[model samples]
Target: MQRPAFDPTAEEVARRVLADIRKHGDKAVQKYTKEFNGINLPPAKFAVPREERLAASASMDLLFKRTASEIFARVVRFGKASMRKDWSMATPKGGVLGEKFTPLARVGAYIPGGAAPLASTALMSVALAKIAGVPEIVACTPCDKKGQVNPYLLHALEVAGATEVYRIGGIQAIGAMAYGTAHIGKVQKIVGPGGPYVTAAKKLVYGDVDLDMVAGPSEIAVLADETAVPAHIAADLISQLEHGTGHEKALFVTPYMSLANKVLAEMERQIASLSRCESITKAAASGALFVVTDNLDTGMEVINRFAPEHFEIMTKEPRRWLQKVKNAGAVFVGAWTPESAGDFVAGPSHVLPTGGTAAFFSGLTVDSFRKRSSVIAFTRADLIETLPLIEEMGRVEGLDGHARAARIRFENPS
Candidate 1:
């Protein structure tokens, strides 16, 4: 089936919110925050106090704090490993050409706190930015009706090295970071995942600020055969469904008809016991797909077309099948490696491209926080030797000024 198009109403709402924020700054942001989130606050209350950040950190459960620390360490190691180094090469003309990688000056991380306080997101975006050597990392998240941010989220942001924290959410938070309100400073780029409104806001502000990706709902595709366990497949599908937005997608593709039927039965059985059974049921009805292909090759084709955010290979030869995957934001090699491992503490950022964007965009990485620039250093002889080529190309393009610039350098050569 073809994917559904984005909601026009959400886009229009986001456009209006962004325009208002751009025109009125802090006043507009406060108005929208109260309207959308039901939390009214003055401009001074926009930022979370430093003492609250520390208190949150101190109040965290000991076990939870330890796990978070371990995940942070793993993510940091992965970020450092994924970072690219600068290198230069000597050209045939004795010129030097290379790419210099530099971390962004200031960046904003949007942690989703509407449905749930995504403390892991603070670790994912903020920690990765810190690992990339970013000097300033700012975070924005929604608060409860009481105008209080979640303690776990506050702790996570502080632990991940956020330089600033804001108690704002939705499109207004995005606009405040992108356009810079009286209370919050503008960031060079914005990174994180959000609901439809947030994604639409990011789309509207693309040129104004750099974005990681237009991430939408969560999605997962599982490719399995007879060797795969029905229970595992069913549980994996239900896991993403429990993310509680009915927009989440879960697909199970297989060559064995019996396996497909068994997995479906298992899903029905397992979902009954889940706390979010209603959400799972709604998501399964709208977004789940079960395909029994002619063979493994056809199953693979279906998965590639979907290009899910998370792909799991549960075939007899899972490693061999991995070589054929070209799309997916992240891949799980075997039944032992579930998508949840990558979602939490697998050392890679769980903020992945969704809504089939994995076909073009990539998952979050340390490099996402850095920008690269091409450096060219040419000697006088190198410029003279390349002058004829430059002049000829410039003349062919119908530009006399471009050709004269190259010729002038030679005319006065000492």
Candidate 2:
């Protein structure tokens, strides 16, 4: 397989797209959509009707309806458990300083609808917001050629407690959510992953509305040893590739070239039988690679440096080697714990940072849905105890008003 050293050009492209989104608004958005997505949405074309969204609730398969409900229930359970609450603690001097947690009043979630129907994403975002006590959750997605929202995606949003469903995509929807327009109300934060254009829009409107991390391509690193089965490693590599273009990378780092070749052969065999063979094949051939390391320690070092979105440790005594892993979006230990399991039914979030961003960013979690504020309270005793130090610091900093305020608190106790 052909591989190149890690590139930073992708980040540069993201910055340029953001500039375009800020300058031309929807006009620039539509042009890019047509050029890239091959879809032309005229002015006002992106808004999906409220009735259609409602009607979509009744149109999904019964099994999907039940599954969507279950997904929301799980997400809600996780989210509510971590919901923010305000708290204040008292000190001996009658001083109190604590923290308060609050949900953003409203949030906008973007669901990518170009190639796949991300029903799960809709459920995860909206249901988590609902559990966090967000007053409103607005969801947006691109429409199909027939001008209809994906039924399953709509159903998930409904189950997850979205207040409204908008049939807009690309920069226009992002702008509407960030800067309230006649058709769409503004939201406090905008989240979820999208194409380059939607991501650019989020970057452009960041100051106006908070955003999640700027996402990059998805990636996976497999730390396998001679004991690891080649077939399992191969299958996992293909699984990451199915996620779409610029969405996957597989690193096979081991001392044994024989084992790596075996895995590559297995990948080639499996790719031939899959329906998305061309994509998986090309992705595997290009994104997948084998690295010959001197030892497991060296392999672990390389994996840590990459900090892939998914890390699979396949070695004898996997648990022992697992402790060595310090970085990754999520670590799947042992042969039984496949990467695909983490993406869906494993109860952890599949929305992870990629392109080495996992070193700093975390996968979507309950923490994403809440914010905090510092809480402070002071009694007369507390004021008197700290007054001299506060006055001294304030005076040294030339903040006479601060010193006076502290002195006044001590002089005039409430």
Candidate 3:
């Protein structure tokens, strides 16, 4: 099936909103909040109150709190394991070359909350930044018409170590984080996923601050065979669609036509019971696709072309096929490992590359919150040994000063 066309208007809108925020700061943010989000919030009210965060935690269900804590622990464990370490190697001429990894001092995380409050997103982004030893993590999410964020979401942000919480979202939130307002401090980097407007804002603000990725709509591809459960396949497809955005893509590729038909039937049956059936129906009409291939090789070819954010292999030997997958933000092997596991507790951040960008861009990782710098220390002997090569290249490049600088050090021997 053909992919949906891009919307140029969204980009234009984001451009205008971002420019307005960059110039006017808090005033522009408040104006957009009233214009877009339909709420009148002053600069002082932009940041969520500390008492409200405490109240959310106090009112959260015990079971849900435990679950959130468990998910946070699992994500932290994965983040720590995946973190890169500083390393150095001795050179032959007694010089040392190495890379030093340092976490960004401050970062902003956007937790999507328009259609549904993505509480898990708080843990996914903030916990990883915390594990990377980031000093301050600011969180932003949209509030309801009542001017209150979801209790669960606020609790998650606090639990995940967000140093500050803001009740703003969309392009305005991205702008405020990128360019500091009187109410909000500028962050070194921005992480988390959002809808098209937020994605566009991130793109426009790329040079101003570092970004996690151009994460747009959610997408999933399922490669199944006779061994795959039709019900499970149907449920997974519907799950991706239920992200509440009609832009999500769900593709099913199978060699067995019979299994494909069964999964379709199962989807029709299961979607009827979903509370978000309207969203699922809209997404299915636009973004859902089913392709029946003659063999597994042809199916694999189709999967590579799409390069979905999440790829599920539910075949007899899922591992064997995994070796052939060159692109995908994340892969779920076997029937037991569902996409939901990776979304929630699988230890990897769900802020993955979308819009077929998995071919080049990678999902969010521990290193996303850190910066790496090459460290080089050269002795006089080392400089002398390399001077000829450097001087020759400098001269060839018409950089006489570069060659003279190296020559002066050797000539003076001071």
Q: Which of 1 and 3 is ahead in lDDT?
A: 3
Candidates 1 and 2, the one with greater TM-score = 1
Residue 68 local lDDT, model 3: 96
lDDT of 1 by residue, 302-344 (tens): 9998988899999899999998998899999998999888888
lDDT tens digits, residues 301-380, model 3? 99998989999999999999999998799999999998999998888999998888788889998899999999999988
lDDT of 2 by residue, 1-414 (tens): 222223345435545554565566666656655655567766476566667777888888788878877777777776667665677788888678999778888899888787678887887667777777788889988877556788888888888788888777766677777877655778898888765556556666889998776554456889888889999999988888876765468887888889988998898898899888888877776678788899899999988888788999999888997888887888999999999877655666677766676778777765677798888787888888888899899989999899998787546466
List lDDT for all candidates, in order.
Answer: 0.90, 0.76, 0.91
Q: C-alpha displacement of 181 in model 1, angstroms?
A: 0.5
Which segments of model 3 are wrong by more than 4 Å? Answer: 1-6
State the displacement of the C-alpha of residue 131, model 1, in Å, after optimal TM-score superposition.
Answer: 1.2
Higher lDDT: candidate 1 or 2? 1
